[model samples]
Target: MNTTTQPTHNTLFITCFAALVATSFCFVLRAFVVDDWGHEFNLSATQKGELLGVGLWPFSISIVLLSLLIDRVGFRAVLWVAVACHLIGTTTTLLATGYWSLYVGTFVLALGNGAVEAAVNPLIATAYRHDKTKWLNMLHAGWPGGLVLGGLLALAQGGGVDWRWKIGLVIVPVIVYSILLLRQRFPVSERVAAGVSYREMLAEAGYVSALIVAALIVIEVGRVFDWSLLLQGLLIVAATAFYAWYTRSPGRALFIIMLIIMMPLATTELGTDSWITSLLEPEVVSMGLQPGWVLVYTSALMLVLRLFAGPLVHRFSPLGLLALCSAIAAVGLYGLSQATGVAVLLAATIYGIGKSFFWPTSIGFVAEQFPKGGAVTMNVLAGVGMLGVGIVGSVLLGTIQDRAIGHSLAAHDAQHATQLHATYFTSEKTGVFGRYLALDEAKVNASDAQTRAVVDAVVAGSKKTALKSVAVLPLIMLAAYLLLLLYFRRQGGYRAVALTQSPPAA
Candidate 1:
């Protein structure tokens, strides 16, 4: 029972919006400042990948843990934890000197981001139960909204600002959300308010979903501790067996299927977006566009489209809209891979429109289809997506670019290749870490004319090849979405599941 005075819907909406802004603010900063970090620290590609991925993987931990606890501990308490993490994370980031400190700071920052999603998603659902999809899309518009603000600020700095100032963007939103959320009443989760038992909520996530989360945890933890793969594999197997025995219900198979699909969906969109600025920098510069402007443009497209998702959802249906968007995004990505000069804008617009609706619409689909699953369902889906980006997407993008560039450079100048390899590449684990090459922006800029020409060719080729590879993910998602549309169609079209309220105890 929520005993405190209920907050106005306007206040909650604004606060939730701010929380997402802060989240995106943290995420988008990597695009602007990661090269700076690499240059300053002489970090390898593996180290940079770890650094950026740290900013994401911890999201999985915080969201999964908080999802299980939020209903029990209450929304206010979980929000305060988010605030604390943000403050602490910012302090760590400002003080960071090298690889270890930067990783810790990013990890802490991601914890707060995950907590925000865990709290706010359910908050909005409880606040505007009838319009979860529309409100959620509107709430999520803040993601690209933050990107626009952050990207413009980076561009204004002429891409030369202190990394600290760029990172400080989150502070304003943190303070605003804190003020808006404090002392306000928080409703019980829809599941709790409707008198659904706690056990039922846990069961909705199921053993399979739990196994996936657990396996990711093992993979991440093993990476940090330098644990052997054999050891990690055994731990994951044990976790799977334990969850299978623990969860008696076969669980919501359809929801579980969506969770699986979320891996590629998340990796393809957020992962690709994270690298957009760097990948397109050469072409954008050649065309006299500010490098960061392309990101701002794409983000603006997403912000506008998400704000109007209500009508589109009504017309196309959520799954139908996703299928259409996936096809467009695939074409956009392929177009981007092949684009040059001012042609990049057209390609970006298509990509932006394609990716804009993916994250929020997917959330809406799960919410509408599995309302009985409650916070766990929503938060786990979110957790899976974040983990995918942090673990698979970030590392994969970084590694492929490194390898492609290395391959190109090796063929161009063997001596320069040696220098570049010494400067950029490093060895780490097999799966995500592998061999990474981190190019130095300062070094590349200062190279002699012949050397600069060679470097340019390598970067351009690597980026194009990487984009073409990632375009495959959206193509896969298109097929999956189409199949889901057919599934829903056969079942009398998409419909929201409404749990019947239990009468109060006599």
Candidate 2:
């Protein structure tokens, strides 16, 4: 489907389009399977999160390396090779059991993912230059759409399924994609612009290039680390004024802060990851569905939203939409924590809808705004930014999970130590979002009166303690992202963010 000689109106467009879907299909299952990974592999939350972050490390490195590669080689070569890497990585996850093996697998996987992202994203931007944001959103939507499918599998086959099988789901697509890509030819970045040589396109002002690269690097690294999401959020409320003296541009800092502001809110609000089974156990029983169906239904809803992502982005500004959706995510998470029986079903649906926009939209926004010469630099930045989110989310959620479990263990009677271990293990099995780990399900088995009494008591005690502890994070993140968002906007001024100002556009 992907062809070289002619413009992207046909071949190139279709290849990149399929590539995006394939890439999304491969990557969307991480959050769903993360906790189960720990359970299957016998790793801790810290271990799982770190391993996940390491999987993300390739994203950071790829940004720098791939950027340079895009200028030298071309998009088609990089895209297919990336697909090949994804196929290999996809298969590798099936066989990994030990921590090191898993880490290595993830490392390889991230590289493939980063490659796909690096190559196809910019290609999309260039292919639909007139409406970059719209196309990018449609492109990004593929990720969540994939996630939705994976989520269904996770439900139909809970995390308990052999990790290898879940991974193989991605491989089928990659093999098919490789066949398609091999059959088709496409233009390299150099060929995108008529008469532009690769060498000439690579040349740009030292000062401008430095700033541009630095900004790209910062965003890539920052998004991966997600430090500002917490730090900046806190800066917004702190009267002590640490933020005022911390940097030159507070607005850009705040933008990053906003990106993650709802994280804490969402964590407690949804209560799905760690407490998913517990939250829906009674309902699952009532509906005559397996416990895992909760995850499936949620994932299904998520996919439905994503498949329609282009239209959504066209109507709602990604940032503005996320802000509203985050508010909704917050409420959905909160509703889940508070709901019972039928209430939970409604809340889960809402939560899925809210979460649907946050990730893909963010990716699209970054791609549309900042262009670094060719597919390489720009794609690297996008990859790094998402990696930054991975890193930040892992660290933040891991700490909370640990602290909560430690408290729950210490709170239990000595006999519950075994129970505590089981709980801890359950949470660990869930990965980063495993904060509540197994604790959320602890009181679910009692009779209605007893369950209500225990839920009420736990809500009165640990939930209060847990919410208080987590609240500190987003407050800090708000200020940081707000500043960062504003700074980037100011940097662009009146010019549209998508225009890559290289000497010769690649």
TM-score of each: 0.93, 0.66
User: 378-464 in candidate 2: lDDT tens per residue?
Assistant: 443454444444444444444455555555555663544434344322532334343344433323333367444543353234332
Report lDDT (Cα) of residue 249, candidate 1: 62
**Global Cα RMSD, each model:** 2.7, 9.0
For model 1, residues 1-506, the per-residue Cα lDDT tens digits are 54423456677788889888988888888777876787787665546666778888899899989998998898888888999999899889989998788989999999999999999888888777787888899999999999998788777877667888888877877897889777566666778777877778877888889888889889987988889999999999897777667666656988888898888888778888777887888889889877778889999999999999999998998888889988999999999999997789999999999999898888888888888788889989989988988888877877788788777766665754356545533333344655334566666666688777767778778888888888998888889888988888899888888866553253
Go through the candidates in order and give each one's C-alpha lDDT: 0.82, 0.52
lDDT of 1: 0.82
TM-score of 1: 0.93
Which of the numbered candidates is closest to the native, going by highest lDDT?
1
TM-score of 2: 0.66
